[model samples]
Target: MLEDFERGRVSAFFRRVADSIPVSDRPASLVITHLLAERPKFLEGVARLSDVAAVLPKPRSIDEGALRQVKAAMQVDELNRDRFADPEQATAYVESRAAGRSLGLLDVGGYFAPALEHLHTHFSGRILGVVEDTENGHQRYEELDKLHVPVFSVARSPLKDPEDYLVGQSVVFSTEALVRSRDDILNGRPACVIGYGKIGRSVAAMLHAKHVGVTVYDTDHVRRVQAMSQGFRTAATLSEALAGAGFVVCATGNFALREDDFARVANGAYIASVTSSDDELELSALNSMYARTPTEPHVVRYSRTGHYFYILADGNAVNFIHGASVGPFILLVQAEILAALALLASGQYGPGMWEVPAEVRQSIAATWLTYFHGVS
Candidate 1:
């Protein structure tokens, strides 16, 4: 059953990417992603697209056979290279590739920030644009007014159809692992979710659905009121949110949680982050304060007040760390990626951060309604 779902998802993604390309003009596109190592289906779909020139994988644990298959599918001698070992190597390779012509960059998690800067510094006019996938990346892109290139972000898309759906589904899966660890973990316990954005709202809703008391913190007064309107308690400050919560979830896409916040946490509470940005938590400070390394993969057990505090996924996105995130529903997000790449390839968007167009958003939503749910 699982294999069948994966196959269909990959096929649909490939078809969308292929359909979006123009026959006469297929520009060179460089894709840098950590998802390739974990989600090979994504790599397979994009690699076969007409515009793909190179792939830079930040490997966690790469499947050698899958990597070979992706490389073979590229069907080009242009910019073929081994996986990047670090940011410096990636920067050098991207600069080398951008030497002659303008290139398109498709990235997740802001991993290619340095390389993009390198292009801006030396090869000022060599970039067509960039397509970013994560909310954290969108926040970073917003800071660069003189970026010299366009950046269209799926995370910042005004159309909330995909983000709302994915965030809700992904958080449910992420919280499952925590529940399994202790059957009655959430019963009558408080879970504090920072941020009242789409992702944070979903996380809080899921927690509330599980009968866990939820407290939300967002700097925006309107967002705070919004949380209150949803029947979830609101916290005026980060410190207030950390008071006695048994579970803490950071989904703000900002570095809102700090070492000081952790100091106020309940002795045996659990902490997790769902945002792609590593900065959401003060992880380095957390490690140094403990004076110990994580005893298990993606989990750290720190002793506090004769009990222990638990940190999930090393403060990375919990859904991804636990298991296949959002299961096959990730295809909806991949469809948006295909649309963004298509827009870039067609030279339709101008400079600065752009929103994913309404047409693309509706098309993807229609695809999901038709194929995934048989809703027509």
Candidate 2:
């Protein structure tokens, strides 16, 4: 059977947010793109609240069984990334599916924003604003020259802080799981974290707690200084960070590592990512340059110049390979997204990026504490 939704903390959190909004203010239709994973049980609850037009499964991290369950239960049009080889094709498909519908979007990694942007011009129906869920997506929206609809971002919101920290924990957990499978241990190893953002900070901290030596490198000088202040060794450049570390984790939701950087990785070191492969590493270039051999389940060895390195999960987020399960704490971010959707449907915000209101974040935190910690 699929995960028990009735007993899910995330499902209950979604219900609580939904109940707080007036039915008249709920969006009439929605297009959602998200990771089809068991831990994130909020999708079904969101579907029940609106006319879900189309559902797109995230490419790398989708859980097939969970996708099947969602498809069977919701009966919404399901779009697969494989069918639309090019991203533009997926955008076109969503446009066709969105015809004549006043639609709101709940997106992960900003996959559908371009489609929504296109729909804004000639769409017959209203374009309710979007609620975006990741820093990567938030940056994608920011890069757009102009926004025709308001965007509510929960990525940098305080409500997401707990989830981000837990995500870091999961990244480390999965990395260790993969390492231990090879009969190796992480303790006393020198590690490099390629970003000093929210998730990267937590990953470095957790690794340090386990007696690992952590070196951090970020393009931002301020973040580098922050890492130094936190008592972790800070690298002056990417090459410096990769040169000696026994393990590497890419936490920046950007192309943090490239083909040239791979040459700097220590031989026999394991590298993993915390976000989508495309956003974290240049896999296509690496594959072309190195000879790849399957080393283990979710592990691959790439060799050149008589030195080699291992990539966990074929460069995808290691946590997903180990079941990207972050537990009930993720519900806080989900609640914020649902609440933002309701606000967007009300048409209170205009065309631009809007932070989730402080009061709304506070209210969500209060409710979370009440429900999970027995604190009002």
lDDT of every predicted structure (CA atoms) = 0.67, 0.80
Q: Which candidate tops lDDT?
A: 2
| RMSD to truth, every model | 4.3, 2.6
Model 1 — which ten-residue stretch has the worst lDDT?
76-85
Per-residue accuracy of model 2 over 12-113 as CA lDDT, tens digit each: 766777777645744555545545565336776676467667666666766777677677765455555343444456546655766666678887777655
Show where candidate 2 strays beyond 4 Å: 1-10, 23-40, 75-91
- Cα shift from native, residue 259, model 1 (Å): 2.5
C-alpha RMSD between model 1 and the true structure: 4.3
Error of 1 at 218 (Å): 1.0
> Can you write out model 1's per-residue Cα lDDT over 1-376, one digit (the tens) per residue?
2466757656775576457554344556777665333356675556444356567654442345656767667532222222232545665666566555557787776655545555655552356778788777777777754666778788766544445656655765666665556543566668888888888888888777777789999999999999999998998888888888887888877786776766777776777777543558876776545744465566667764455677777667777654434544566666677677767667766777786677777777776677667776
Clashing pairs in 2: none
Query: How many collisions per candidate?
Result: 0, 0
